[model samples]
Target: MNHHAPLSPAAELHANVSVPFERAFAMPKSVYTSPEFLALEQSHVFAQDWLCAGRAESLPDPGDYLTMEIAGEPVVVLRDRDGAIRAMSNVCRHRMSTLLQGRGKVRAITCPYHAWTYNLDGSLRGAPAMTLNEGFCKEALGLPAIRCAVWQGWIMVTLNPEAPAPAEALAEVTDLIAPFDMTGYRETFRESFRWATNWKVLAENFMESYHLPMCHAGTIGGASKLEEMVCPTGGAGFNYHWILKNDSVPLALAHPSNTTLEGDDRRKTWLLAIYPSLLITLTPGYFWYLSLTPDGPGHVQVLFGGGMSEDWLADPAAEAHLASVRALLDDVNVEDKGCTEKVYRGLCSGLAQPGPLSHLERPNFEFAQYLARRIPA
Candidate 1:
């Protein structure tokens, strides 16, 4: 755990990940800057884990769908005719073309190449002009199915067919977040952006609020008091903490219907990181999340969404409130982008060695531990 330790693959990893929370150091810069390590994570970590897509509520109707890339594998996530959500390979069975591009609705997923069509359930329905090929059996050809499920209203797809259900791994906190009514929050805004940093960097940043008072001093961070924060113990798949806010701030105010929380919960903001890359922040009046995907060791794509609670959504000032919230969040994001990108540049400088973790950075310690176990030895 020494900061000045000589750098090697194993030594670098050990330097960052092998230490107690109080004496912990940041993961080596190589962990974020090495393409070799990114490839390893793609295979052993992302490919084997259940990754969150957007909310299932986004696709309320049958045949509605969204597509995302998981560990370099393109996947189609959709609700079929029977209202069952399914994840299947986006690669068409014929000619290997991407069947769906992005989020949309369709009676059937039809390939832009060669006109191969598939039913909502991923069954091959037609293969035009394939009669000439006697070996081509339409019934036998279909989009390969991937493991998928809707848990707590979020759509999650795993590239590994044998992975356990996402809900099962997340059970430790199911009751903990029940008060937030995760399913009742409808997405009112969405933004997709890329950060010039590793996905883990962004994930670690979002999991803890240690830098809030400084990084976001002018916005929501102004209300964050470090002394009042409560960090939950790490579990198999998640880490969370609650930061109590000043009651006078408009941003810290509670929703009218948020009666489930009492005392400190009334003014507390909850931040939860669900395993590898799903980060959620819940307040009494609103909730937002970041679902991150890595494009490379130094590039991360983010799917960001936020929404109001049922109480606020019913208010006459909902739109105005939402606009203000969005603006505040945008400012916070800009600040974060600058901070993380700069850190990435520093890490790439070769002089950036592992640094000691703060008491507030316990979540980062847990995250490093999680990554260490899954990364190739």
Candidate 2:
């Protein structure tokens, strides 16, 4: 008898999705509905890849910290005493209690359960009434460290120590948009919320601009010309598209004093979908991004943030521009939330099936392939 193992449902779906762009179809509905599929992604993709936590600038001072979960593992990214950003387990070494909650400045990582304190560097500093235990050693009992690096100003953390550095993996992206000086853009605001949809559904939504005219009709739709949207084949770690338009928001275009980006380049907006789950909308005068994590098969956790470039920040009308940008983004987000949730609802129906791909959804096609390559059959 032949010893061939049958392909998994995910692998079969992947095989169907891995065709040429012209013949490509949307990812099957099971990808968004199956708990098993989500588990595979959690282990093979989220756990193995460099996941963006937030902007490094947000954790500038020593003891500043932000907490997030990766594939169910609690991780805290913080600036240590030496002003170096690092990541470590958010679980306390004693009693296995969570070390921190949300984001804030802390002198030490202390577990509220028993007051087992760890320094900002994750080294165990104090554990009350532990001297009686003969096996206890504070030096060896510090919180476990996770691999972390800053790439283009974003703080990235990984559970796999052997994974490639963010810079090395995103080298092509770095060169592709170098003139923008993405690292120089400051984050003005960030908010975390849950969405009623699969993480991939939201990721695909961000990867394509095909739905702007219909889904975002009330907000930015009038300004979004589908004819101007260009979707090219994606790179190994990311996919990107371009929208060249005279922006409705003045600050969205390049500043008069700025000379780096010339001509139409000043009005260009890059929709970048970094592999697994970081989505960025980078413009000459401003930038915004969404970092996504799966809450379950039916829900996703989102870190939404955006801000202005240094030149725009220095402009006399900066405050008004920022307020306008924030208002527009908030409205856009409301539109997206409704659309994505409806998609998720449809995926739950037995009648739902993968449809043909749009030329503008090339990035989504590439994203399906990426998922196929990562999750085992």
Candidate 3:
């Protein structure tokens, strides 16, 4: 009688997903549905990786701050008086109350519960009524700092001190996209919302162009040509694909006055999925991104933002162009919401199984491998 021990779920997943691209299939249903898997990912992947916070330019002055949570730890990213971006614990040292609630300019991080104030640099500025306590030491009570770095204008933070800097990890991507001068693009707006779907479902949806003609038919679908997309093998820190745009959206192409990009490069769009969960759509004229965080096993929180490049912003009809782009993105997001939510629903069925991946889904396959490598056996 054969008495081979049963494989643990993580071990089985690792074995199944670590195959060559030609033999790859979609990830198992448990990857998106299992609470235990999600917890493992939170501790091992999200907490250890360099997560994109937002563009540094968004916090133009000292005291401008944004709050986000990483693997259940609240963090506040702010500009100090010295004009450097900093990330620190948003939990007040005293009583452990959350110090901030969203993004805005602030004079200091003040805990709403007890009003223990912290300076922009996260040093304790004041703790009312604490002077009598001999054990209290203000010098030793600053909010603990997290590792923070800026790469290609994006603010990245990691709780793990040993993670590679974003710029160092994404050096190849920088070289490939050098001509576009991504840092020259300025953000115009940003918003956050929750969607009722697994985070990876939305991430995979963004990684491939296979569903563009069907999922986004009413919006940006007309510009996507399955035959024109190029999906090369992915690198260690990222996956990418390219699509040549049609004339359907003028802003999706290079501006008339832009001389930096020439010929076919002007109409090409790069879809980049930076490992873990930062998805960027970079075009010659504009760029947009989605930063994802898992809210739970069944839901994802998204940070959506976009803007035009310096050249496009200087155009005589820039406002009209931006308005059109925003409108189209809104419609495309609605379509994606519907599609990803349905996928999650199907994965919940007892009979649901992963199918073989299409050639265009090369990026998705690479993403699965990334997850498999990060989550321990």
Off by over 4 Å in 2: 1-7
lDDT of 1 by residue, 98-179 (tens): 8898788999988998889999988999888888998998888988888888888889889887887877788876878776
Candidate 3: tens digits of C-alpha lDDT, residues 68-167: 9999999999999999999999999999999888989998888999999999988999999998899999989999999999899999999999898888
| Number of clashing pairs per prediction, in order | 0, 0, 0
Which wins on lDDT, candidate 1 or candidate 3? 3
Q: 2 or 3, which is superior by lDDT?
A: 3
> Cα lDDT of all candidates, in order?
0.84, 0.90, 0.91
- Candidate 2 accuracy as lDDT: 0.90
275-319 in candidate 2: lDDT tens per residue?
999999999888999999999899999999999899999999998
Cα lDDT for residue 169, model 1? 86
99 in model 2: Cα distance from truth in Å?
A: 0.8
> Which candidate has the top score in lDDT?
3
Off by over 4 Å in 1: 1-11, 248-252
